[model samples]
Target: MKKIAAFLLSIGPGLFCIGYTVGTGSVTSMAKAGSQYGSQLLWVLALSCIFSWALMEAYGRYAVVTGRTAVNSFKTELKFGKVLAVVLIVGIVIGQWNSLSGIVGLSANALYEIARLFLPGLPAESYWAVLSIAVVILAILYFLLIVGKYSFFEKILILFVTIMGVSFLISMFIVLPPPGEIAMGFIPSIPEGEGGSLLVAAFVGTTMAAPTFVVRPLLMQGKGWAREHTSLQSRDALSSALLMFVISASIMVTAMGALYYKGLTINKVIDMVYTLEPVAGKFAVALFMTGALSAGLSSVFPILMVAPLLISDYKNGELDLKSKLFKRLTAVACVVGLSVPILGANPIAAQIATQVANVFVLPLVIGGIIYMVNRKAVMGEHRAGWLLNTGLVLAFIFSCVISVIGFTALKDFF
Candidate 1:
């Protein structure tokens, strides 16, 4: 029992990554993939998550051993690091903008649905009503962030992660997927159709996200984990990655069991309210809503912090969330995020765009890290082993292929 408690006590950075990773974007993507192609794409989810874990472990080790964040490594180590940081930050800002927007919009929509249960008089169908809820929520979040300490904020994130994970699992149990079919999902194979490739790539891209890597070092620093904690860091990374996979799979299974065969199209996250009913019963809507709300809240919280975190990294400034400028920047980001749902941009579409951007930037980021981590001057004895190096090389190639597929699919938009 003491050992278990110690393990929990030691966890911080990896769990923080998970809180941001398993957000509305993940839920939406997994749900769509499951509903469209059932469990045929689970292998993609597993593979993406494995790559995510590998990258995270590498990032964590770099931070703990070298005492350098990714942005810092980029600026000091590589010749074009500054230019790359600028370009990457631009991508981060745009991607996070879309992500937070989807998160706020989706959570507010779920809240509005809940409001309808109690206040039948409320205009439940109104987007403005949802927008109003989102505004209030974001305002509360801003206020909490400004006033709350890091420990308080971290606790809130853990709470959100717990609520979302438990609620989703409960809903999954109620829905009860077929074990035989789910078992076959372990075998990797793209579905036979036009959407299959896109869905497969999305599953890989969305599962881990680019922001998680950017925020990882910051979170490690925040946790006060040092080089001595390297083993702990690996444990935390593995544990969090496994938990992320479980939560993601549970969501996929829920969708597969409920909406897959019905031929129902899921365009919005809110559609789950209706689609989940027949399989999990009406009460399950509330469970799904609870999980979705938790997901959105957890996601929005980190997303709001992202701009400040990255900006600090770029400028080599202290990561002070309490600073007036940081708070102001975060406030601006919140407003931009809220605009997505208020302006009626589709959450799923925004998620896909952000994910594609992730894939597009991945090779460059991964390539740079590979160079940095392999240098004896940088890592010395702590450099990546052959196994990690091999995994990373494969991940870089895989990410490039996924990016090509994504760009090919969206060539018309370009």
Candidate 2:
């Protein structure tokens, strides 16, 4: 027990990263992909996790060596650094806030689904009920943000991540897919259909997330890590990526087993519950909803923090939770997050669109980090080696390809 506790403590930032990465967007993307394509897109998830780890290492190492967060590094290290930093802050905040709406919406809807499971008399489509739930959840989380410290939030995220992982893994085992089909999913073949391009792009966007890498250095800084912690950072990055793969794969495979084989699809967050109930039983549905709720709630904290955190990063690379600006910005995010539920928008669609849009910023993020890590003035003796550079270059190329796909996919939505 002591060893396990020590291990969890050591990987605090990585768990936080997982909490951010494996949110409702990821759950929806993986679930949608599995229900539609049945493990065919697993290659994308695998590649994204690999590149996520690589980019995280670059971002974390730069912070550790130079004692600078990503936005601060961008502002200080690059030519036209100030302009780039401002652009990144604006773009990521816009994207993350948009995501928060979908996240809170899905969370509220999932809770409603669970509630209805017990009380079948609840209205089938109660917008106010969902909005009320969203209000309460956001209020609670925002209160925690105001009163809690970074370590407190970190511990909370650890618990959420654990619930998400355990629930999904157990549910996956309950509806385990064939080993052969799971193995074949790694062979790398794109699904051919209308939404294939969008799902492909979203899979990459949600996993190899720009905010995850950008926020990583900030989290590491929050942890008070330094140059001597580079090795620890690498291990954390690897573990984070691996766990991302495991939880993501589990969600996908569970959907593949329960829905794909049974010829059903997930059109919304609640569809997952309704479809899984008859096929996998009430217990499975409960567990799935529990996992989804955990994913949604875990992500809300980081999503709310991104705008203020990046603004802080650009300003001085320090996180000041006590600042009025932080409080105001977070409050603004909480209100914005209620938009989807109040507007009665489709949470699943909102999440997918937000994630697809995230692809547009990836090239800049990957390019910026690569440029920063390679600079001798910033990194000095701790510059990124050729191997890391190669991974980043590949990530950049992948980002460009997915951006094009995302653009093409977005056209269909209009």
Candidate 3:
């Protein structure tokens, strides 16, 4: 019992890392993909999980041995120096903006659905914004008021993850997924329509993109003591990340496997959560809404941690996401996130767009990290092993090709 407890405890920063893996993008974009393309893009989801593991594992090791965040490590060892820094910062800002906006919008979509039933008297559009805001307020209060439990940050993240799992799994069973269609999910193929292909790429990108992946070491640093914790931290972080991947892919497969099979196409992000009874059944509605609500809340907590990290890095090259400026940034981002309804209430479209942007932004970030990390000076003896190097190179090439193909496929789409 003690051994098991200690093993789990060694993954001190596990929750925060998982927070990045499980976010609003996972819910909206993956749901859209399943609804639009059925399981045609299940391959992307599987591939994304693999790449996430590689990318995050690299990021974790770089931080542990060097005692630096991925950003700082890049700055220290990068050859192009100023030019690359500018590009990285730009990408980070845009990615962060789109991500936070999409998450807020995703959360709002769930609230909008819930209100339509529970408080039919209120306007869903505006009331959703208010509800989302209240959720942020409530979460912040919970984080602040919960004392020692939440100050750790990962504790709250763990709670969100637990609820998310229970909620989504229940939804899956409630929907009573068709076994044959679920089997077909593993058979990879591109869907026929242009929209189907686009959703596949967008879904892949969104499921993989989030703040915590890049900023993991900072959160981990606050939890564990030093360089000695490096390998264990990486292992723990990877496990947590995989847990999220399972939950995310499960929701997508279940939603797509069942709903899309019925010939009902999903047009908005909220449609998955709200269109349950109208299409599938009352149980479907309840299950999806429950999953969506949990997903929204789960995502919000990590963004709160991430906002401050971005601010601190900008102002002081530190990841002290606790300063007043960082806190204000987090709050403002939250407010902006909640206002996603203004971007067009077509829940699925907006969700997919942000996800597409993630696919677009990925090449830059991933390419930069691969170049920076493998440099002998940066990692010394701790550099990626030769086998790992070969694998990473292949993964990088594939990512670049798919990303380019995806962008070109949707050319002229602004």
Candidate 4:
């Protein structure tokens, strides 16, 4: 029991990040990629996960060494820091609400479908039913954040992640993707198809989101980690990010093995559930939905955390998680998260907007991190090494290129 307790206590910022990164957007993007192109797009997932780890490690390290959050560092150290901080706070608040709505909306779909198993007459086509389910979930989440202990919150997220990881792994094993084809995905090649390029770009953009870094410093500080914990923090970041890759790839591989060659395409996020039922059995379908719902619920907490944490950073105010103002702010954010779902946001449209649209803000965020990490006055002896700088530069350039690609895809969509 002691050992088990110790293990759970060790999970921190990295686990929270894993929770946020693998939400419905990832499930939709990865599963679609796998369904349409087999394991051919695994290379993109690999690269994006690697980039996420590198950038997250850098951000956490900065916070530990400098004892400053990203928004705090920006507000104090540079000329346009205040503007940058404001931009991040506003952008993430808006972006995260969109993401939250999508997540709850997606989860409600799975939950409603599950309900249909026991309640024979439940309406499968009711959007308002989905909205009501989402509202109830949102209210519960909001209440928990307002009243729950911070450690309790972290433990809940880790539990959800565990549920997601186990279910997805088991589902993947049931589907059993071809080993040779999976290996070929590592060699990196463009998938040729109608939506291949757009999917690839979306995969990269969503996986390496800017908010991941923006939220990192706050989580690290909240955990009371210091410079001495750098190695531990790096390990946490790498492990969580790699775990993200495994779960994401598993979704893809399952799609490839079960749906791809059968000539079925995933048109909606929940459609993967139906695809699995026909091939992997009802049990596999239930397990996959369990993981999908876990993924979606896990993200709600972090998505809510993003804006409040940033607002605190910008204001340099109290860090109490249970304060009245904190609760009010979180309440307002929850309302924002529910805005689209309550209005009957289409699942596909929500996925596109949340997963791919907000990525347009990545370049600036990446650039800000690059500038901050290299400044001697802020980092002092803990400045980023040349290797880290190289990675940042490459990440920045890659993000810019992908953002352009994503925008072009959007333009073509309209």
- Give the residue spans of candidate 2 off by over 4 A: none
- Residue 33 lDDT, candidate 3, scale 0-100: 67
How many clashes does the backbone of model 4 have?
A: 0
Task: Answer with 3 or 4, whichever has the higher lDDT.
Answer: 4
TM-score of each: 0.94, 0.98, 0.85, 0.94
Show model 4 residue runs off by greater than 4 Å.
1-5, 118-121, 317-320
lDDT of each residue in 257-348, candidate 4, tens digit only:
88988988788755776678778877888888888889888888888877767788788822457656677777887887776677776775
Q: Point out where model 3 deviates above 4 Å.
A: 1-12, 118-151, 176-180, 273-275, 278-284, 304-307, 314-317, 342-344, 375-381, 409-414
Clashing pairs in 3: 268-348, 269-347, 269-348
The candidate that achieves the highest TM-score relative to the unseen native structure? 2
Q: Write the per-residue lDDT of candidate 3 for residues 214-327, one digit (tens) a residue.
A: 676676566643568667766875686577667877777767656777776676654564556665666566666666766666666666555557545544455574456655
Number of clashes recorded per candidate: 0, 0, 3, 0
TM-score of candidate 4 versus the correct structure, residues matched by position: 0.94
Which tens-of-lDDT digit does each residue in 238-303 have in candidate 2?
Answer: 999999999999999999998998788889877887888887898999999999999999999888
Ranking by lDDT: 2, 4, 1, 3
Question: Each candidate's lDDT (Cα)?
Answer: 0.79, 0.90, 0.63, 0.80
Among all candidates shown, the one with the greatest lDDT: 2
Spell out the clash pairs found in candidate 4: none
Native-to-model Cα distance after best TM-score fit, residue 96 in candidate 1, in Å: 1.1
Cα lDDT for residue 405, candidate 3 = 63
